[model samples]
Target: MAKGAHGSRQAAWEFFGAELKRRREEAAFTQVELGARVFVSGGYIGQFEQAIRKPQLDVAQRIDETLRTDGFFERMWRKLIKDLPFEAYFAHVAELERLATKICQFEPMLVPGLLQTPEYTRALYEVSHPFATPEYVEEQIQARMDRARILKDATRPEYWVILHEAALRVPVGDPITMAAQLDRLREMVGEHKVLIQVIPFVAGAHTRMGKMMKLMEFEDAPPAVYTEGVHWGNLLDEPGVVKQVQGSYDLLRAAALPPEASLILIKTAAEDHRRCAKST
Candidate 1:
């Protein structure tokens, strides 16, 4: 039987969960029996089957081995691992992003992760996780970098990003790192990999300030709106809510500078950062 056919249509993770359940049953293993082989509780297996939880990489691998599925679960786990480094609440959003046909995002404070350079990503992680071990920090940086691969995929999504002027101005690291970050944005804009609009400081406050919002449109699923805070995030999929948020994002995009002008502003900011680094 096809995955997810046993239940209402849902996200890819849910489909994966359904497939896991089907395979377990075909192998004549009860949830408890499977959990014993995977070293997790029967309840955890139930959560996986119901798509209420995601399996860790190790757990997925163990399940694959126990079920003799020839690495089927492990292969699916690799695609899902792109969600790593994100909070658990937002993992599904990451998966959605990977599968999206188009993505639009607004960032008020920092550069979007998809556009961040490795150096820039590292600096952000170091500051945010002040007490994290070097290994952990490196692991997170790698995961962030890995997420960028979606932008380079054969079927890359059409990306449109609206960045607040404050995000460009605030120095995440030293002048050099900031300059490189800005240059990176300029380079991507030049390459036409993404469409960028800058909400200039002169434009003043507008709709959807003080929070980061991303709207993702998928080819096979309904659109989603994601909003995030420092330690938490919400993925909104209700049709009414998604429509409202999409309208707000459209307004914000209209209020921002045009792409040509935004590119200039970004390049100018990069030059200014370079000059500041030279003077200091």
Candidate 2:
């Protein structure tokens, strides 16, 4: 079985590659010895590190049990299966989310994609995308909803969002639907599990409004950043690029309302909407 067989094209071979290298080190085996144990060529191991390909399940299981990694590879395999239909662009983002220890998201426009309520998400999508007809809308909804599971996974990672004020004020769909959406945001904030900060309209002349981004950190690799525009997305791996994005986000965080303050703002907005709904 080829490395791609395990993941096919779920988008983060580099992560799988890093995991393989880390396990090999923990097992105290050279690539040649580890490869021999798994019946893979030593060069195959090299390629896995290069992320040119990944190892198959049979090989993955052998290494996992031998190194006592305790189902890391097995669980990874399962997650990859669920994300099989991920688009190439989405696949890359999904992979980062999978391996991330912590994720910091900045939605200079709408709510961060991962934390969006279904109705709000659909509203945003419908406005931006002309291609999502009724049939496609449902498909897109399922795909978007699927991402919410990551927040509840056993390996649940920390989530932090910096939502721009415009994202909250602009009523998507309608006032009623937008009210429900704000209420959903309030509920999530109440859990105390996710932290949210609002970048007010007052904080003018900011950086990167046209592009939204997520900063992902993994156990093995250095942290990396991803930014997306209206159509295409770009991943930044270089240390300099990572630093720039991280710094910009840090500045954004400083300029925005603190988490606790943001929660109050969100809750107040929700209540105001509910009251208006009753009066109508």
Candidate 3:
């Protein structure tokens, strides 16, 4: 039977635990026997089967070897890992991206951060990682591009993004690439699932926080807010606190143009970039 969304997440936990239990039982091994093979206590084996403890790589390998299932744990690891090159920082973002029913993003940097073009993102990363080799930059760009692909899937989440005017004025790459990136932004506005807003520099200082923020609403879970900088992100899910952050977002939206006007502003900026590219 097809499971509902909430059921599916819960089912993943159960399914993973049950798989461990089934493998042990199928091998004619009791909890104590399996623990002996894997160099763990019987209580740890029981906990593994009960979804109370996640397996480390070494333990996972030991468990797989004792069960004689070649690469079972490795296969599961691939499934558990998201397409993230940034590791710990991206983990929370990955979960939110997967579960978000609606996402409201406010980006102070160029474009909505998630919708950033490879050329633009590379330039930004390059500034931050000036010491990074070419290969490292490519890795980051590929990771970001892969992250963006989630929105292309049939189950794409609803996305509404607000971009500060400063984001529009900043040229991340060379003029040509900048213009192409702007054009891409313009084209993306046509996507029915995305709402893009450009808050002009002329809007002046309102809720002038220097970083970006995302408000994610979920199906069965309470909404959360995310803020990221450099190497870390904080996810706020506390009840009353999330409400206040959302209220702040509401006021921030008021400081920016409505959807229609925001579109016009974005298109005009794209056209200006195109003109600049041609002149240069």
TM-score leader = 1
Task: For residue 119, give model 3's deviation from the true position in Å.
Answer: 1.4
Give the per-residue lDDT of model 3 (tens digit) for 1-280.
1125335644565676799999899999999988888877776688667654444456778888888889887567455544235565556465567667789988887676568888888888888889999998998887677667668878788998888877777788777777777677767777775787777778788674576888888765567788887787777666798788777778778888987888787767777877888887
Model number with the top lDDT:
1
- TM-scores, each model vs. reference: 0.74, 0.70, 0.70
Sorted on lDDT, best first, the list reads 1, 3, 2
Q: List the residue pairs that clash in candidate 1.
A: none
- Angstrom error at residue 132, model 3: 1.7
Candidate 1 C-alpha error for residue 110, in Å:
0.6
Clashes of each: 0, 2, 0
lDDT by residue (tens digit), candidate 2, 149-230:
6776778778888888887776677667777887777777776547889987788868776568899887655676888765
Task: Give the lDDT of residue 28 in candidate 3.
Answer: 96
For model 1, give the RMSD to the true fold: 9.3
| Residue 133 alpha-carbon offset, candidate 1, angstroms | 0.8
| Model 1: per-residue Cα lDDT over 1-280, one tens digit each | 1224213334766878999999999999999999999987787798788776567667899999999988998888676554346566666676677778999999998999999998998899889999999998888777777778788778989999999999989999898999999999988888878999999999988998877999988764567788998788877766899999989998999889999999899989988988999999
Candidate 3 clash pair list: none
